[model samples]
Target: MSTPIFPIQQPASIAAAAAILRDGELVAIPTETVYGIAAAPRLQASELLLHRFYDADSWPALPLLLAPEVPLAHLARSNQWAERLRNYFWPGPLTVLLPAIADFPFALPTPCVAKRVPDYAPLWPLLRALGGVLIVGRAAHTGYPPAITAQEVAEQLADDVALILDGGRALFGLPSTVVDCIVSPPRIVQRGIISAPEIMAALQRPAERN
Candidate 1:
């Protein structure tokens, strides 16, 4: 089947994309960091498809795209650091790591999950349409650089991805910074646009007032 590239400007296209997701198919979408192949993790079909598309290395901790409205406590175990980071740089590129609750959107091999609520304007309506959460992995094959444009995603994973939501080139064009709040004084698992120092400052700022 030919993968369709949908423009976010049209309401019809967004609706179609949502329907595809509702059917448990993969969709390649854009965020400030890069293009991603997203799946509705709770669906059995999506779970099978994701395990097939991504390799062992890339499968351990997948990114969960969350809508801003999603209750933080419902997704991950309550943690001060997760809340701090979310308030600091959410609706933007910053994956906050936390221990997953039993009902967390899908099954994860590990107890911790990396979650992000993209700040990009164009990705919101679709996310909102899908009930505020989707499982996403980089569109490119494991180990290859992430796809920064919709065409790049199409070229690399058209066969696997059902649709591509074109949102132009990624603004950051780099992987998101990840902070692991599963531990005290959250650890920086992967550094990208947001620096380690910046994250530390945000986490430390609250203590300074005491």
Candidate 2:
């Protein structure tokens, strides 16, 4: 089956994208870091589609990308430490791990849930409008190089995604740094655009004096 495509010219189109997403369909959406394959959070079918597109080893168990302002308590099982981290590094290029909720659609084996609040303001309306957990991650093509431009996304995932919001090349050509906050000493698993020292500084803030 051929995927649908949408050119993201303005905010209004996000509603259209959301409509598509609600139907368990795939959309190649733009973010500050990279284009991502996004689906409505509660829809298992949409999550499965995204997982298959990425060839993710664990289908349905995927990380979620959230709007920065979305209340952490609503979507995550937060503790003092998790709250501190969210307060510090959200709305930027950091993906933190926290405990998962039963409502979460993905099938992540890790006891913690990985979350990202990107810097794209335009994308926030869509995130807020979606109103549930959304499984989003870097939209890279299978077995090929990662995509930095919308054109690359279209070229690579043309056959998979129902919509492609071409907002041009990503400001950052790499994925965000993923840190496992579930552990006592948070560890950096995948280091991307954000550096290790910067993360350590954020984690070791005086407010988080634990």
Candidate 3:
């Protein structure tokens, strides 16, 4: 069960990666922040595979990366602040936690669903082609630094993952800034690349919590 590394520059490779995801297999995909193990969130088999291979803590309330056009209304109970912040910093390393609409077609753990749209160019086409919830997280165990390159991902995950999209090292080499927009005055759950002050400034309001 050797994991295969695919060059994202190749259209065939991208297609193959998408096929693997459609088949409910896990793929290590590159993002601006770090390499993430990506899988189809709706598939039970995929969920099981993700839970079994990824760390337990990593599975709970994991963020699902979506394309820019994936309607945020269905996915989040957003407010003016949340919407403004999303407008300002989406398609980047910012994960927003919003109140989940009941019976939303994803396997999100809590009443809130964490979602984001990465700025990575290589993944856009595959995301457009897949057209479904793709759950992703840093491709490493708990307490380890996030994997940045395909080789790092392969080293950490080994044969557990089905494929790795080699898009070279991550630009930030850091994790995404997690924000709990579910609350009034969005709170910064975890700060990574984006700072709280920056987020507050972008929101054109004061951050009550950090």
Give one digit per residue, the lDDT tens place, for model 3 in 94-147.
888888777677565556667888898778888887784577867886778879
- Which pairs clash inside model 3? none
Task: Put down candidate 2 lDDT per residue, 16-123, tens digits, no spaces.
Answer: 888878888777888878888887876475546555654545222256778766776655676665666677777877777777776655455444567888887777
| Candidate 2: segments with Cα more than 4 A from true spot | 1-9, 54-61, 102-111, 208-210
Q: Candidate 1: lDDT over CA atoms?
A: 0.80
For residues 103-122, write the lDDT of model 1, one tens digit per residue.
76556667766799898877
Candidate ranking under TM-score, highest first, comes to 1, 3, 2
After superposition, the stretches of candidate 1 with alpha carbons farther than 4 Å from their true spots are 53-59, 207-210
Model 3: runs farther than 4 Å from truth?
53-60, 205-210
**In model 2, what lDDT does residue 56 have?**
43
Better of 1 and 2 by lDDT: 1
lDDT of each: 0.80, 0.71, 0.78
Q: Residue 21 in model 3: shift from native, Å?
A: 0.8
Which ranking of candidates, highest lDDT first? 1, 3, 2
Model 2 poorest 10 in a row by lDDT: 53-62
Q: What is the C-alpha RMSD of each candidate to the true structure, in Å?
A: 2.3, 3.2, 3.6
Task: Write down the TM-score of every candidate.
Answer: 0.91, 0.85, 0.89
